[model samples]
Target chain A: MDRSKLHSVIALDMVEFEFNGTPHKSPPQTTVAGLLESLGIEYRFCAVEVNEEILPKAQYSIYEVKPGDRIEVVTLVGGG
Target chain B: MSTNIHRLSVAGKLLESRVIVGTGKYETLDVMRESLDASGTSCVTVAVRREKLYDRDGKNLLDYIDLKRYTLLPNTAGCFNAKDAVRVARMGREILSDLGNPGADWVKLEVLGDTKTLLPDPVATLEACQRLVEDGFKVLCYTSDCPIMAVRLKSAGAASVMPAASPIGSGQGILNPNNLKIILEYLKSDDPDYPVIIDAGVGTASDVAEVFELGADGVLLNTAIAHARDPIMMASAVRNSAIAGRQAYLAGRIPKRLYAMASSPEEGVITSRPW
Candidate 1:
């Protein structure tokens, strides 16, 4: 019934999202690193951008994902 | 008899070979490796794009390439905007640094516009070139075969200004030698050794030779060899043709004239009615 309890309750009920243009759902206690790890995307060869701003690789461990975060993960592939 | 070894000097690095080969479009890693070996290229290009890697062996495209033997030139091939190109260049720099080649800092900028044509957007290319150069990154920018654009890119601190012979992957092969000649003249007039590499649309060995004959410092292509029926053999031909063309250019070609002129001296030639 309190404001802080209401905020926590709303956060617990969060879901759904976008990653590299595809719609994705967020599991409970998912960080950026956790999401990428679960998807089997290796971090060493790629860099991540959250909501248009590129985050440093070291921040991957602590950068928490929001419900509407537009994440873009890019890597180097065979191209001309 | 000029037996001097021609080196491709750009961004202050002296490369043993002037031909820069592309690392894409090959059937397999072994094929790519063999083709590269046959091409005699001291440098090879690699494009930056997102690829899914699920294997634990770290078997990647980069792994196939021996960085110690070849200079891996990372390119911003598909970027259509300046910002994206700059980001990709930075990521490439980071990736190479992480791979233990910390001094490998050159980037090939290709800000392509219109997917159908796949030509570079001049404005975006220039903008990316300037920004990347200012960022302390050596930029080899791919531009249209227009002297003005080539000049502008050189002024923007591009270590090498590349003009496409035709269009990327078109296999047109020196569609406009005059345009490339103009680009070379404009850039080299000021700095006679300014690096002007022909970037794309090369079809075969003769195409490579024609570009060299036109006085371009180097040529870069992917599909010409990778898509060939025999990639390694084609690569060998390309290498030989590049060398031959460069040598011919150095050897001094005969001048064109409206009327025929005897190569032999008239005095030395015996007349039909011998005196």
Candidate 2:
């Protein structure tokens, strides 16, 4: 395949999503745990929200990310 | 009676310390950890927020906080509305429950009406309290020192009603003592043991003492200790002040009178000559 054709095919397989308000690109069907692993975060230490809904830790390994999904990974922070 | 034995109980959870410190505003995580230890609080407040990713420093707050020692009272500090507060409450619960902490079933709920004041919205706070209670959460609701709002929160099933001494982080300290007194009377009138915590606006150790002196069940503060010149020393001071204040409250002071009452016996008047 030509170089440009190969690049277009690869782009089709990638998914664009939002992570903590920043845009991110990941492969299709990337699970929450997979995304966290990519970010060097431990799934057990934080809570994940997909499209503003909390994704249970039990579902982190099973839940798949879709394009345009807004994923928020949250943990404890210092506050009054 | 020693204040140490008189634990503060809220929703069946007994906290050994009457002072609940917030783990916030310290210069560093090390200071926060040491301050928490110095404060001698059995519970500490923490907020839930988006994690910082891809940073060179990979430290987490949990690393500093010993779960076995401190019950994490997760707070929805930045949430402005009921829906967002409820959502954050659930997330907090989820995180703690996964870690097998007892604080999983409870949350410190704050729904601010305005950003500048950081004062809770009465309507939103009440609504969020009810929803959280319905969800099996023991909500510790934070609000202004409005006695009526405190009553409303109690009626809505909050485990503890935390009234602000002043606007959050302002450090002005107990702006309305009369309203707080009324809150204590109204809340404890029926259930004497219902916990009423004084949260926010504590400027120094004396502010904490004043809170317990007013007969509050407990005092929750952050900036007073965390932002002090010496946080650990301030924590210790606040801790001792809480004990001293509670002891003084139980000891009871003499009633206020227009004329001065001499501490010494009037019969021994040889050294007492008043013009």
Clashes of each: 0, 0
lDDT of 2 by residue, B136-199 (tens): 9999999999999999999999999999999888899989999999999999997988899999
- Against the true structure, candidate 2 has what lDDT? 0.90
Off by over 4 Å in 1: A1-17, A26-29, B1-4, B53-58, B102-104, B257-275
Please write out the lDDT profile of model 1 over residues B132-191, one tens digit for every residue: 999999899898898999999999999999999989999999888888888888999969
Off by over 4 Å in 2: B1-6, B268-275
| lDDT by candidate, in order shown | 0.84, 0.90
Measured with C-alpha atoms, the lDDT of residue B12 in candidate 2 is: 84
Residues A20-43 of candidate 2: C-alpha lDDT, one tens digit per residue: 999989988999888988888866
In candidate 1, residue B199 scores what lDDT? 94
Highest-scoring model, DockQ: 2
Name the best candidate (by TM-score).
2
